[model samples]
Target: MAENLEPTPVDETSNRINTPFNRRNFLKYTGLTMAATAIVLTGCDDDDDDTTPMAEGSVNLGTGDVGILNYAYALEQLEAAFYTQVVANAAFSTAFPSALERSILTDIRNHEVAHREFFKAAIPAASRIPDLTPDFSAVNFSSRASVLATAKTFEDLGVAAYNGAGKLFTDTGNGLTYLTLAGKIVSVEARHAAEIRDLISNGDFAKGDSGIIAGRQIVDTNGLDVALMPLEVLQRAQPFIKQTIVATGLPTQ
Candidate 1:
C-alpha cells in the first residue's frame, strides 16, 4: 500500500501539521534559510573573459562560486521543467492512478519549482544563467514505468550532482555557508531519490546496485557517496538539456 504522502504545512517549532505546503511558504522558508549567505560573490578572475569562444550555441557557466551556482541552477531548471510536464501531461491521471502516487509526484513537482525559483532569486541577474530548455522528447509521460524511470534518473543525478559540487565551493566563510546550503538541498534531493526508488521497487531505496552510483562508481566500498567532476556531470546531463553548457569556467579542482 502506498503511503499517504500529502504535503502538509507544519509549525516549525511545534512540528504540528496544518495546511498544505504552498509556494509562498516554500519561498519564505528558503529565503529565511539563505538570508545570511545570500551575498552574491563576483566571478573569479580566471572567468573574467565571458566572451571566451565556445561552441556556437554553448553558454558558459561563469567561474568560481558563481559558476557552481549556475551549474546547480541549470540542473534545477531541468528538474522543475520535467516535473511540471509530468503533472501537466494529458495522461498524468492514468499514469499515476493512485492518489498517494499523485500526491508524491505533485509534492516533488512543487519542491523542484521552489528550488528553481530559489536559484533564480539567489543568483544575481548579471551572473545567473538563462532559463534552460529541457529536452524531454524521449520521455513517455503517459507510461508509469517510463515516467518513474525518468524520475529515478533525474533524482539520482541530482543527488550526485550536489555531492560532486559540494567540495568545489570556495566560499566557505561564515561557518561554511555555501556547503551548508548545498547540504540542505542535497538532503532533500536524496530523499526524493530514495522515494522514487522505492516507488519503482518495493525495497530498493538505498541499494547500491543501480543508478549513477553503480554505473559511475560514485559510491565507495565503505558506503560513502563520492563526488563527480562538473564536466562529467554536465556530460551525463547534456542529452536532456537543449542548450549546450560550457563548464570550463567552473573549478576543476
Candidate 2:
C-alpha cells in the first residue's frame, strides 16, 4: 500500500507578526483555508522517479494554462522541500538556536506545502509534473548564515517568478480566478521574503530598486518587485534541484 503523504503536525509556537496583510488575509481574500495540502518530495537521485527521467537531463513543463500552473507547481515543490528539510534536520536547532526562528521556519514550511498542494490539485493529473528531488548539498544547513542566506534566495526567487508569471494570466479569455490566485500567493511570498531579509540584514527588502539586475533583483526602481521569465527562473533554480527542467511550451513574451 502506498504511504500517506500528509504534513506532520508542527508543535513549535508561531507568532504571526503584526501585519494588516498576511497568510490570514490571504486566506480571507482567496477564500482558502489552512485545511488543504500540497506536493511531495521525490528522491534526490536521478533514478528516483517512477516515470522515466528526463532525456538530456531536462523535464519539459507543459504549455499554455496547464504549463503556467505547472511552472508554479515546480517552484512551490522546491520551496516546500527545502523548508521541510531545513526544519527536520538537527542542524537547524543548533544553527538558529532561537525558538522564534524555528517556529517561523516551520510556519513557512507548512505554507509552502499548502501552496504545492494547491497547484497539484489545480492542474489536471494528466498534465501534472512529477515530484522533484531537490539538491541541497551546498546549503550547509548546519550554519545559521548558510540557512538564512538560502532562505533569502528561495523567497526572493519566488517573488520574482510570480511577478513574471502573472502576465501570462492577463486577459487571454480565461477567467480571472487564476490571475487573482497568483496575485494572492505572490503577496505572501513577498511577505516571506521581507521577513527572511530582515532576519539576514535589517532593511534588506527587495534590492532590485538599488540598481540590481532586472529579473534577478528582488524589486525594481519603481518599487515594483522583480519578474523573470519561466526559463530564466528555472535556470537560476537549476543548481538547487537535482532534476533538469525544460520549458518547451511555456510562454516567452
Per-residue lDDT of 1-92 in model 2, one digit per residue for the tens? 21113235222232111111234433543455433222111101223222234575566676665677778988988897777777766777
Q: What do the candidate models score in CA lDDT, each in turn? A: 0.72, 0.67
CA error at residue 92 for candidate 1, angstroms: 0.6
TM-score of 1: 0.82
Where is model 1 more than 4 Å wrong at Cα? 1-23, 28-37, 40-56, 213-220
Model 1 lDDT per residue over 47-69, tens place: 34452325665778888787898
Each candidate's root-mean-square deviation in Å? 8.0, 9.3
Q: What global local distance difference test value does model 2 have?
A: 0.67
Clashing residue pairs in candidate 2 (N, C-alpha, C atoms within 3 angstroms): 38-117
Question: How big is the positional error of residue 188 in model 1, measured in Å on the Cα after superposition?
Answer: 0.1
The CA lDDT at 54 in model 2 is: 53
